[model samples]
Target: MRKKRRYIIVMATCILCFFGIIYFIVPKILFYTQMYDNRINVAIKNATDIHDLLEEAIHCIEKRQYYSAIKLYQKVVQDYPYHKKTEGAQHAIGSCYEWAGNYKKAKEAYNIFMKKYPDSKLAEICRQHVVELDNPIYRKVNDAMVDKPEQLDKIIKKCQKIVNNSSGQKKTDAMLKMGECYFLKKEYLMAIEIYQEIISNYPDYSRIREVEQMIGVCQGLLGNYGKR
Candidate 1:
């Protein structure tokens, strides 16, 4: 009877140990799962907060307070790295860099945005800015307006290089700018040739009509004296 009692005691001890292990492990597993769910819910709740920050940044930009807008965007990018608003934050960084007169940094930031979010609408705007930065006449005009007309020849040469290296819309824009540079210098014939090339090669560009009109003006200036 003592042996029987000892055996029953051992069995009860084993049962308790089994229940103790389950009790400890089950609660741990449930706690972690609950914590994960809570994290997700918090992220969802804060999603709109990110959007509100972006809207406020836009308002700051419209008011010409670029530095303030940049500060807010930087916060959005850093604080919500995993949020859907990150792409817009990156694009805003690029725009802010441009406004801050850091064109090289702006271009780098834009390149990052393009690589990370190629299908984003903001990527298209960044691409356009990249093209504008590459344009010789645009840079020259900007420099001339800013009291740096000495950079004009350098800008023109850069445009020529761009024309030689690129094709399609980019090359067409380069060619058009090269023509404009020559026109600015009163080199009428060179300008006419470049403008005519645009008419022939980039006829689908939106600026084709403008190029055609410029070509006519160049011809008249070059003494072609034809109506047309």
Candidate 2:
């Protein structure tokens, strides 16, 4: 799975580079950008070619060939945004990423749609999708945009949902995050308890080492270093 993810990352980079855009990632931040300002080259293709590509891409999408559809959609965006189905293509591009297991990229694509066609009928619908993507349980509460205590409480509730409703590795990751959330709020005792619960339940999970480190950190913060 990791290799496949890395391969897709490499391919995504090459595809974007082929058309003069770049995708960069920062481990701790959300940023997505692509530029196609003065480089739109419609003069090289006749009108009929754009139409054909649009139809073909739509066909590919219906066949669940989203990668090819995305390439076709990118071509239309770069060569012919004036195409009648450009907005639909943009929406489809976002859907492709969502289908392919990268909600972050899907959000970025949907964001592009919102920026490019804010008044479109799909704009509000896409914004709702973005909110769903940012539900905070999928990541940790530390990654949430909480500038206040109340906001932190909201994040805690969402993270707790993941702990309660999920199972397997998903539940484990969320449980660990639940501890991290408490730790962030300076609730060291609760954080320590959560970490200990994880250790007891998931002794053989892959992230046990990280969980142990978090447990130690929480203990240290509570001034219990000598107890260990």
Error of 1 at 14 (Å): 97
Taking the tens digit of each residue's C-alpha lDDT, what string does model 1 give over 1-228?
A: 999999999999999999998999889988976775464444444647776566556555444455666767777887788887577578768766665556787788889888988976667767877786678755556546223545557768988999889888888877877776675565778888888778777768665644665564456455453322
Candidate 2, residue 158: lDDT: 74
Tens-digit lDDT track of model 2 for 87-165: 7667768766654556788899999999999987667657866886687653343335223445666766877898789
Query: Model 1: runs farther than 4 Å from truth?
Result: 1-48, 140-228
lDDT (C-alpha, whole model) for all candidates: 0.68, 0.65
After best superposition, candidate 2 residue 22: deviation in angstroms? 30
TM-score on alpha carbons, each prediction: 0.38, 0.38
* Candidate 1 clash pair list: none
Number of backbone collisions per candidate, in order? 0, 0
Off by over 4 Å in 2: 1-47, 136-228
| lDDT value, candidate 2, whole model | 0.65
